[model samples]
Target: MSNSPTLGYLIPQFPGQTHIFFWREILALERMGINVALFSTRPPPPGLISHVWSDEAMKRTEYLGNMDPRRAAKATLGVSPALWAKDVLREGRVLAKDLAIASAAAQKLKESCAARGIQHVHAHSCARSALVALLAQQLGGPTYSLTLHGPLSDYGPGQRLKWRHAKFATVITEKLRKELPELLGEDQPEKIFVQPMGVDVNALIRDVPYHPHQSPQQLRIFACGRLNIVKGHQDLMAAIRLLRDKGIDVRLDIAGEDDDGGSGYRKELENRITELDLQDHVALLGAISAEEVRRYLLSAHVFTLASWHEPLGVAYMEAMSCEVPTIGTNAGGVPELIRDGIDGLLVEPKSPDALANAIMLLARNPKDAQRLGQAGRTRIIERFNCEKGAELIAREALDLRVSEEI
Candidate 1:
């Protein structure tokens, strides 16, 4: 390997079902000549490594939960007292528990990165992982940066705190980037660049090419996300009910795992499925692999996720890349990803009527639907491909490494 400065990636979790975009970015970065060391602040899911990509990731990842307790204690105390106090005062009462755990993990993660010759550490999110990066910088390991993907307000006062310490930061949407100064409560928040997450568009098209629309067939619809309230699976069920009531035959395949967030929600989704008597029309494929998701994307007449307050979703692009027309709520970065009438449709969040209407509109107009699918695939290729997105962020990381050194 070339002896360039190594870049370390710190995430709150490593290789979960929804993080395929991240893994794609990591692969692209590696191809672009960056040696990346991965660190995780969360515990691995039960069964330990379900997907091939995740299994490969697990082999190289460092988990905070896996560190020895004695070593963790020693590292916790190893931080300079002044720096620890600064974080406490900076976070105040809100992030005490998170701050403490992240601080300890940062020190341990720093040691891991050092052994691997990592010169810069980066994390995705303004919360725990970013906190770990900030703490690692304090422990004199490596300078760090972060990428903000969601509502900064959700990160609480910690968002502002991370901004102050991160050597640089990235936001996934133009709206988020434009609002960075307000979000960070800091001047020159332009230092926090706009770099959206994405998938390997070319690979997707090659592996799962657009199947030409066959003559009048029952529509196959697919939705994917964690089985939780914010994902709006219930609302989707309601829309499906409306479709069936209207005699517009459709089959909905909802693919996602119900982790901690799915406990009661998954059961509720099942209840709704039975109540709607959509047993034949809908199937809940719990926790499918990425390849399975691609199959659904390619097979489906249209793909959609009616998420509430979602940050940019990778699934939308994955579907569109396969020339599958997609739909999403006009929430967060969805609008940025989908052109309302051109590529994919956008509906109001939490409104099953609007969702059902959009589905019906597409269902009735097969030619328009195919046209939209084609446009969506073209959009992913022209703008949202993994290498293009990855190259931008990788450039930022490389520049940050040099700037910090200077």
Candidate 2:
């Protein structure tokens, strides 16, 4: 391993699920004696991690100056514009806004590298951060790489131009990798890699085995992810109702942020709980820290996520690492991580009955659930450790750089 290769980690916003996952990988890389630098479009939460470096990656970016006129026109046509035209106009403003930010950040990164005699750049997402990384690469001679995660389809068109300029792009699933060539054209097939997101198996494995079914009266079922449409929390709520109606005393603790900012979904979730009379059974704990999540994982009887499509769920891996059995919707790359019947159960997406039945089966059969959870933890320890992921990515990145230089 070369200690001299400077690896710059770049991201747009630095505190969400993506940032937390990347942070774990960064820590892993650093522990492996790699020189790593971190950059963001905006500063991360204070006191989390010391910045190796920071600066505006770009400047003087222009976006829709005034969208009020457009909103007025749309409103006149009987369209209920979600926000003032300004917000709608600013929707994609991140491209230009981030382009400017990345340019400024890249220049500073180049100077930082020159001072440290650094070598390469890596961005966490193929979104705004990658755009910034691309610009930085143009200004500095460092080779650039990127990891592509969610909002997968929406980013393809806009990211095509930027991706073409990258040294290599890593995606979390083979599903996305297979679609990339068709989406971005067949010419760049060799530049893409299907690298699933990884988990810290050692950190996740607790000293005490997770005590399953904590309450004699209540069956504790847990699901976690951002409270968004893609996660299908609404469907999970419906499944909870179905299980309750079957005379099963089940409790669900859903953890994640309502990033939609007090929108109807949050209210709708509350209203659904009221309508189903599930107020006593379900709890929506918004945005708990990672340490708290591990506790929840250790406490719950079974872990579940009924998402419509997941690139590769870090939460699933976390639960698995904690020896908690998982039941997820069979969509996206979920199957890649979960082996149905062996590690965890896989249910049909959007099917509340299927989900509820799976939950009921596991809840009723403690032995089976324990077997699955134990198997999952073993699988995680053997496969999903951060050291393994970092080594694979680092080796591939170094190879790509060397091949390009030749």
Candidate 3:
């Protein structure tokens, strides 16, 4: 414990609703006696930050997004002009904006690492936070690593620049890891590990045994994810409409808010609920605490998310941890997480008919749903434990002296 170096934990938005996994990993690292210095690009929108621990997380995080003109100039000057030109030409105009943001934070990050005795900076995002870590490492900061949570394209351009000099990196799925070499070509980082983010199985345990809502007419579905077009909430809503049309009363509670709070895409969803005449069947629970989610998971008959594409879903894992039968779309890396018809059910993405059918399969068969729920819980407890995920980060990124018993 005494020999371990402080690890700088970086995430773009520190404690947003979907970031409970990050918080669990931080706690796990601390439990392993690895000191973690939290850093974020900036505070998230006030409306978007909804976890119970968000305030505490914000207090601990050091925001580094504020651009200092003098430090920005020095940081930009430190990079070779030829490399900058090459990056711009290769990656496009987006590289310039990313570089500018990275340059603004680099020197500040370096000073913070030095002051805090942080030996390694691990960026939990492949987006601009990765760029921030890369530039900071270049400016004599701690050695940096990255964890790719989704598709590289989602992170924007400068893939080569981001991965070229990293100490190591982790992708959430083997699919992503296998594709990395082809994507980055010659500039791929040397040490890339496959590590999925996970939820706290211990904390997410159900206090009471799960039983499908006894009413044959009602199917209570619980879903948790950010409100976005890609999450397939609209599809889920359509599926709900289908269920109702088939004479099954479906009640769906979706816990999330749009990136811009309720002012943006949420209105579209709300209107859709009205357009579908699902005023009583659907409720959009804006940005709920993890505890509330756990409560919903405990009470719900089925848990599901219809992501158009998901890179190993933590929301599904969280529900499974609560011994809830989960239905997920067969989108990116999700098959790696759930065994179709065994631990959980998988439906094709954006297919309301498929989703409706899958939901009905569970709704009509309580025994099968219970079996899946039990199997899902066992799967999460054995394989996707958050503590184990944290230990991987500690061992690989922070070089922590973890006990063999772990």
**How many Å off is the CA of 12 in candidate 1?**
1.6
**Residue runs of model 2 more than 4 Å from their true location after superposition:** 1-4, 43-102, 186-189, 211-215, 260-264, 398-406
| Cα RMSD, each candidate | 3.2, 9.1, 1.8
Task: lDDT winner between 1 and 3, please give it.
Answer: 3
* Superposition error at 253 for model 2 (Å): 0.7
Per-residue CA lDDT of candidate 2, range 167-204, in tens? 77788887777777666774352567767667888678
Better of 2 and 3 by TM-score: 3
Going through the candidates in the order shown, the clash numbers are: 0, 10, 0
Which scores greater on lDDT, model 1 or model 2? 1
lDDT of 1 by residue, 1-406 (tens): 4665577887766777678888888888777767878888774574223456777887888787554666557667766656546656866866767666676677787777778877788887777787778777777778788888887777755666567767777788987776776645653334666778878976687455555445357878899988888998889889999988987778899988676534656888899899999999999887778888877787888788989868888888888888888888999888999989989999999999999999888777778888999899899888788887566666676673322322
In order, the Cα lDDT scores of the candidates are 0.78, 0.69, 0.88
The 10-residue segment of model 2 with minimum total lDDT is 56-65
Q: Per-residue CA lDDT of candidate 3, range 69-146, in tens? A: 998998887867765678888767778988887887877888899987888999998888888888888777789989
What TM-score, to 2 decimals, does candidate 1 have?
Answer: 0.91
Total clashes in model 2, counting residue pairs 3 or more apart in sequence or in different chains: 10
Q: lDDT of model 1 at residue 305?
A: 92
